[model samples]
Target: MGYFVNVEPGVNLYVEDINPTGSKTILFVHGWPLSHKQFEYQFDVLPHMGYRCIGLDWRGFGQSDKPIDGYTYDRLADDILAIVDALQLDDFALVGHSTGGAIAIRYMSRYNGKGVTHLVLVDSAAPTGFTKDTADHFLHLALNDRPKMMREVTDSFFFQYATEEFCDWFFHMGLQAAGWSTAAVIELLRDENVQQDLRQIVTPTIIVHGIHDRVIPFSQAEEIHQQISNSQLLPFYYSGHGPFWEERERFNSLLMDFI
Candidate 1:
């Protein structure tokens, strides 16, 4: 079940935590304007694999605090560090998507990446700028023409990778929750591009991406694989950005093996 966690004094952080009493733990970090709920499918299936899965709702999203101050990467990364210490998790797997991916990378670079035994990046942002023009071009559509742009993104993020129902809850989450402002999300996106170099991750990393991912094409994953000295790439042929949603079973199997 999910809980209202106090990552720090007066800081109410929300986490969709499920400790199946498994020996191994996996901490799933979500991206911008979304909650820990993004990993719902993962939580449901990973446990049976003898693993405990936990997903965190980053600040400003889900039930977490959304104060006007402290939305920067340094601040977000700090929150993650706090959660790690608060929960007393160790030897866990760290999986992140999109902006969450950047946060994980930053965490590995800044801190010792405590308790992180393995890393999985799902269509995560590179430590640099991507097709900003493509994303920028869709801003008006995502705001002014939200439904239309949502459909397009849904197709690329998951529908192209799996069945229609795979992304039903994804769009539902957007409708049920108060989303991030366009300006704030745009600012986050602008900063999501990495300015620092992190091509030398010292851990076992698995970079996964869908072949048809319009957001960050497969080439981006290729670059990530080539750069991370100890990492490997696992490509999905018929998926998009949210490959886990598209091919749930396959995604789970791959994760089980990788972990």
Candidate 2:
């Protein structure tokens, strides 16, 4: 029930209509390296329960135009804002994974509580190191040595439970995503500090962290829950970064209850 739609000039966005007829709207944002389709589980299940779930591929990741510009997390956040305005959606649940979590957090800061009713971060990326070492690490892997180092980086990005097929699809997908400039990735990986910390976030929030998530680590989730007042955390015992894939049933159950 989802299809590609032109969201902007030269920036055709991939929009999946999870629940085109549902009354409640769910806005889902994907992590790095994957497109809007990453939230396929939510799109499939949430809509059946009467929620209009939606997900979008960040520019340069999915069907969205891999333009040379608009790679900055700030601009990416702006893109989401534009989508909300274009769709005229109000009173929706917001969910994001990995870097999408960071973008969601930034978006809330700029447009706090306008339409977002709840916030969910699944194995999110936040409250982490934004120092020289982090930048140098990502830079060396993504930009240095013909981008071959991205293989190792991508490998660690997911948990060992990830399949060879999934890993292949994920990495190759990022490469084919077109026009993902090294400078943009570096800037994103370098100045990736959150403009708005989770501590200031006051909406009803849920943090889902996979215990074996070596990518962001469960400790980061714990720290975020600790900082973000009134937020709750659900530990996924059998999954890693993408628990929605590794532990799909349990993820659906938890999300359904929360919603």
Best by lDDT: 2
Q: How close is candidate 1 to the true structure, as a TM-score?
A: 0.87
lDDT of 2 by residue, 1-259 (tens): 6555555677766677666779878888987656776666666677888888887777776676677787766787788887887778888888888888888887887667468888889888786533567657666666555346457646666554677887777666566554345436556756676635676689999999889886677988888888889799989887778888788888878877777
TM-score of each: 0.87, 0.86
Give the root-mean-square deviation of each candidate in angstroms.
2.6, 2.6
Off by over 4 Å in 2: 1-10, 129-131, 144-150, 179-183
lDDT of 1 at 49: 71
The lDDT of each candidate is 0.72, 0.74
For candidate 2, give the lDDT. Answer: 0.74
TM accuracy, model 2: 0.86
lDDT per residue (tens digit) for residues 1-259 in model 1:
7776665567677876686488888888876445788777888888887888888777667777765556666777788888888788888889988778877877877776777889898888776533566557556665576556556655556535355675665665544323344335546666565536366468899988888777777787887787777888898887877777677788888888878
Root-mean-square deviation of candidate 1:
2.6
Worst 10 residues of 2 by lDDT: 177-186
| Cα-based lDDT at residue 125, candidate 1 | 76
**Native-to-model Cα distance after best TM-score fit, residue 202 in candidate 1, in Å:** 0.4
